[model samples]
Target: MEALFLPQIQQRNGCSPVQPAFPTKVYNGHSQETIHLHPFMIGPVTDTKVSLTISNGPKTLQLEVDLHDTVDQLKKRIMQERKFGGSESISLLYENRELKSSETLGQQNVKNQATLFIVHKCNGG
Candidate 1:
């Protein structure tokens, strides 16, 4: 009987080690069958930008943004454009629900030409 030694697999970046689908046949310190490993590929990002209308009181601001942008990113853009002071906190609302800072616009279903209400708050006295 011949002894087969498998290579040590290590986990990276908190991800689990990849497990083989089935047992591999090893012969004379070499794999008898060819093991094809394909690199993980991510799909290309689209350049499509959605137009969003932000309503704050009687004033409305038009913004064109990518769907992948998070709510915090959008708020930063608004702050830049409006020259909002650091003391002001901005909140975005869609359909009466507050948008989460960590969530993307696409995840929240904020489509093109969508109207988002902006609520402003002063941080301190």
Candidate 2:
């Protein structure tokens, strides 16, 4: 009998596993059969966290966030941590470029342990 093994399918960032459309096939002489593997054999997806260091001049802060978290959410976290007033405008910069509030960390290609800069602007004098 001959057994064929297929390569494991994984999604980007190794966050999840993709199942194949067909099951393992075993061939013996003039006969063929299929075997279904248990779902536990495929393993489970682990929760991956992205850590970022945000710097505002001499002060710095560390944040743990998900890849799907948007820049706006991150800004809110920063505001809460820093206790900034509502009139304060917060800007996040990664690699010297300003990050959009609607964009996610994954969309921005922000890797773990990446350093970001914070710029604060107060509306009205």
Candidate 3:
């Protein structure tokens, strides 16, 4: 029998395991610049932590949210903690990136001990 290798699975976007190519840039000697690139790794299936930082009025509060939930569910938890109404809007940021309400915590590809930024909506006329 011939040896068989497991096929590489594709991401949700249907893209294969294609490597990213970085183009070289030439800069003037007098100018100084810094370019930072973080390599993305395929994380294991594990329980992740969701942290939140909120700006309510003039104070900032930080709290931890459970990752076994959707973004909207987390918002409900925050609302309860802050004693805010259920209709109050909120925002979730993952890795300094913003996520929509329809998105879930796991769908964002967050790993263990991930820090999520929670911002309560402050509406002013």
Candidate 4:
């Protein structure tokens, strides 16, 4: 079976996951300046408590979940708690990263005390 992996970091769009998507800058030895991406990211998905603030439109939901759970599971829980019928239309965005359904919370680099934006996917022609 394929391992469920989520993007780790603060993407232009925000979402949830095990990795913490904080941005980092590296300085080159030469006078020339350059920006670089980190090879890996991390999150606080351990025994420690992780709090997430989910915002959907005018409504805001605060959820606490285990790091071991999958992102899809988190979506289900959110839909159940919010009484949202259209789970298919929902997507979790945090720090510019869109959380994939097949990935786990740890894969997405979701960190403690991060704010997630619950938005609907746009339809295209």
Best by TM-score: 2
Tens-place lDDT digits, model 3, residues 1-125: 33332233234443444344423332444544323323355777654665656544555557675556777776776777764446667777777778767667677775555555656668993
Rank candidates by lDDT, best first.
1, 2, 4, 3
Candidate 3: segments with Cα more than 4 A from true spot: 1-68, 83-87
What's the CA RMSD of model 4 in angstroms? 17.9
Candidate 1: segments with Cα more than 4 A from true spot: 1-48, 83-87, 122-125
Q: Which regions of candidate 4 fall more than 4 Å away from where they truly are?
A: 1-48, 83-88, 122-125
So what's the TM-score on candidate 3?
Answer: 0.43
Best by lDDT: 1
Models 1 onward score TM values of 0.57, 0.64, 0.43, 0.55
Clashing pairs in 1: none
Q: Candidate 1, after superposition: displacement of residue 16 in Å?
A: 36
Q: For residues 6-78, what per-residue lDDT tens digits would candidate 4 score against the true structure?
A: 3333444343332344444444445343332444535653474578888877777888987667878888888
Give the candidate order by descending TM-score. 2, 1, 4, 3
User: What clash pairs does model 3 have?
Assistant: none
Q: What value of lDDT does candidate 3 attain over all alpha carbons?
A: 0.58
Q: What is the lDDT of residue 3 in candidate 2?
A: 68
